[model samples]
Target: MSIWWSLHLRREAASVPLARRLLLGTMETAGVDPDISYDLSVALSEACANAVEHGGDTPDGTPQAYRVTAYLDGEKCHIEVTDSGPGFTAPHRAPRPASSDAEGGRGLCLISELADHVQIGNKPGRGGAVVSFDKILKWRKDAPLMAV
Candidate 1:
């Protein structure tokens, strides 16, 4: 089975958890393993938080928003978060191992650790940061396979 959903949210702090909660609820209902669901949820939270922080502004300084997309295909799950901010110019230095006392700069590192694959770049022709990742999904044998 395959499934996918997308959300476009204002660049606000509260939007972070809203996206995570939606992903978690969908995963739980789909019979995804709790451990995998939790890992993905935390990773999603990090991505959303980054978007809220750096979404920047539109050409006319219109309100900015971020987008989150999740896809499940029984064997794997793919997620992406995109922000309307200045995109990376140079390859980002590898995210440093966040220090215990640090309150910032850890999101990318955590996502790297959790996701099987990650790609960070500009949204084609959109001039913003795009962070996309995928994880191998482990589903219960009896879980319903719903085509999405």
Candidate 2:
């Protein structure tokens, strides 16, 4: 079975820092390669930011909380970013990047390009959605050994 770690927070922007730390800590604990930490951090942060922005608040204008779950399975680390707001649909894939544009709905697109795998959709049994992704760990043969 895979190992798992979870973090829950409210809809406020302040919670982002805490989320990042937890994710980094979890990855480290699971023996993820130090070299890929930056990629994981950026991808996870983007997913969590989307959750906080779109899923945490009630569609009716009330405040709500959010949750982020991360786990490691053998050679891959998985992350799920979920929220308390009503469910939403993932945006359709955009066409090739225009040569001169600077702004748009490219967050998910960028994440998909970076992460090994990406899943975005509603959380079953719960309202709202989750943006999940996984990254394959690259082991360093010369690194100090740590018992699994």
Candidate 3:
């Protein structure tokens, strides 16, 4: 069986945890390994946080919202977070590791570390940042919704 979900969330700090919790709950119910779920949740948090922080404003100066989408299919899970920001200056490149003393800028690097594969780019015509990742899943032996 396959499961998927999407959320069009306001770009606010509170939305980050909301997205994380939904992903965690879905993973838990699907019997995904806790460790993997944790890793994905953390990555999702970072992505959402970036959307909240950097998702830019509309021409009218109102904050634009972002979107988070997830899919669990067969033996893999895919997640994508998209924002209305200016987009990455260098598209499709793995971000450089942030300096230890830097206050921020580690999220993309951390996401790349946690997931099996990652793609950072811009949405086709809309022209916003898109961060998508995939992970091969390991299920608990007793996973209630384990894929056959």
Candidate 4:
């Protein structure tokens, strides 16, 4: 089975869980393996949290909304979170924060560890940060998500 969705949400703390719930519901309904679903959802939460906290750094004031997109094609799932904040200078090499006790700065590190493939950069033309990731889906034998 193939499924896809896109969400444009306000850059607010409340919107983070909304995005996560949608992802979780879609993955569960699609019969993706529980472990995989959980991992991706956690990673997605980190990405969404980053977007919410940093999405409004545009010169003309912070962007009011961010975009989250997810696609499931057979045994693979891809997700992207885009924000209107100033793009990251270096997402290709996200090292753990120097201060372990720091309350933040670990989003990208967590995402990189969970996702099989990840791409981070500025959105085409729009000049925003885009964090995209893909993982091979592991499905439950009886979920009927695909031929599996």
Top model number, lDDT? 3
TM-score of each: 0.89, 0.76, 0.96, 0.90
TM-score of 4: 0.90
**Per-candidate clash tally:** 0, 0, 0, 1
Misplaced by over 4 Å in model 2 are 56-62, 90-104, 141-148
Q: Name the best candidate (by TM-score).
A: 3
- What local lDDT score does residue 24 receive in model 1, on the 0 to 100 scale? 91
lDDT tens string, model 1, 46-143?
99998888888877877599999999886889999998888788777656688999889899999999999988878779688999999998776566
Model 2, range 11-42, lDDT digits (tens) per residue?
Answer: 77788878888777666765567767668788
Q: Locate the minimum summed-lDDT window of 10 residues in model 1.
A: 139-148
- RMSD to native for every prediction? 2.4, 3.4, 1.0, 2.0
The residue pairs in collision within model 1 are: none
Q: Which runs of model 4 end up more than 4 angstroms from their true locations?
A: 57-63
TM-score of model 3 (CA atoms) = 0.96
Q: Write the per-residue lDDT of candidate 4 for residues 1-148, one digit (tens) a residue.
A: 6899999999889998999999999988888999999889999999999899888644667556999999998879999999987677654565465477888888888898999998888877766789999999988887867644
| Each model's lDDT | 0.87, 0.72, 0.92, 0.86
